[model samples]
Target: MKKVVFKVGGSILQELPESFYKLLIELKEKKVCDPVIVHGGGPEINQALEQMQIESTFIDGLRVTTEEVLEVAQMVMCGAINKRIVSLFQNQNGKAIGLSGVDGKLLQAKPIKDGKLGFVGEVTKVETAWIDMILQAGGIPVISPIAAGEGETHLNINGDTAAGAVAEALGCRLVLISNIPGVMETIDQKEIIHHHLTKEEVEALIDSGVIYGGMIPKVRSALASLQGGVEESVILNGLEPGDILKYLDGEKVGTILSEKEVVEHV
Candidate 1:
């Protein structure tokens, strides 16, 4: 069976409908594919930091983790957000195990940029055996992106990056669940979603200014994961009901980013 790693951000966690959880349960019950979720807790962490009077900062979509920030991040991602997701799945009658990269050494890492980001590290390794165990046990693994670094240090990881690593390690597809439908371009006065895009095509679109602003980072991140051995990175709207299922069912519901060339949607 195939496995699909989902990267869900905290910004959309509350907005995800019950139908989404139900769909996940349905997929598991039907043995469609093993669905693994790697989640972020950015907004929640920010809120907690504010309550504790700590400044929140980021560099290129990655949080700058000070010692205090890491503490709060751990509490939020591993404690609150993690359990909440597990509870949601359990509420839907789906068995789920919430975990952090620190749990079972699922993800091992080291400091990046000479610790310029301060406890923010990139995943150097992903232990896929634990994830396989959970999948074999008929349970979904909801992972928080807190990685175990050298010594006793715990590091904060990017949700997308973590999910990409997991997908690459498992040789599975990476589905990035976000608010937007996909990469859109106005053609003939109508907004159209590009169903598929290659790395070069994405760059051309960015140069043409069709892809700009917030989407730039998202698409670039997806493309970067392609270079990291991920077969495809899918960007779709989690807010839209059935978009994920539609894509899974072979309907054109999102933008698929791959290194290879493909027919572009016109």
Candidate 2:
């Protein structure tokens, strides 16, 4: 079966309708694509931290994970949010198994920036067989981004990077689901979707400040997924779940990234 990895950000996870979950169930049952989901819990984590009287911050889409914050992140990402998604699937009669990177040693990691970002980690390696097992059993694997660290430690990883690493390891397709349409360009004061982008063009836009905020790591992750052996990487709006069908059906749906220039479609 062909594999497809999805990175669903926390911002949209809560707002997603039942229709989205149904589509996923339909796709999996039909064997359209073996879907592996890597999800983020930024907003949820922040809410939890604030309620617990802990401060949380982010740098370039990656949460600056302090030991205290890491505790909350794990709690929210692995405990609450993960189970919630699983329950949602069960509610819809869909099959899903929620697991953390620490589970089955799925994601191995090392500290990013010499531990300057505290417990923030960069994915050093991804173990795909664990995920493959779940998929082969006909269950979607809902993964949390917290990774296994050296000797009884755990690290918080960027969601997009985690998804990219998984895609690379599995050598599959990756679709980063977000709230927006895709990478946007402000041409003549109008936000225009790039429709398609190359790494060079994405970098140029980033350097020119067209791509900033959370989008920086998102595009970079898409690029990484492409370089990491993914057959295709795209940024798609989860609001329109039907677009996923369009994309899987080989129709243009979102911003498809490329390493080399490709002719743009109207």
lDDT of 2 by residue, 149-213 (tens): 99999999988889988988887778999788888878788878887899999999999998999
Q: What TM-score would candidate 2 get against the native?
A: 0.90
* Error in Å for residue 110 of model 2: 1.2
**In candidate 1, where is summed lDDT lowest over 10 consecutive residues?**
257-266
lDDT value for model 1: 0.89
lDDT of 2: 0.87
Q: Rate the local accuracy (lDDT) of all candidates.
A: 0.89, 0.87
User: Whose lDDT is greatest here?
Assistant: 1
Models, CA RMSD each: 2.6, 2.9
- Model 2 Cα shift for residue 121 (angstroms): 1.2
Candidate maximizing TM-score = 1
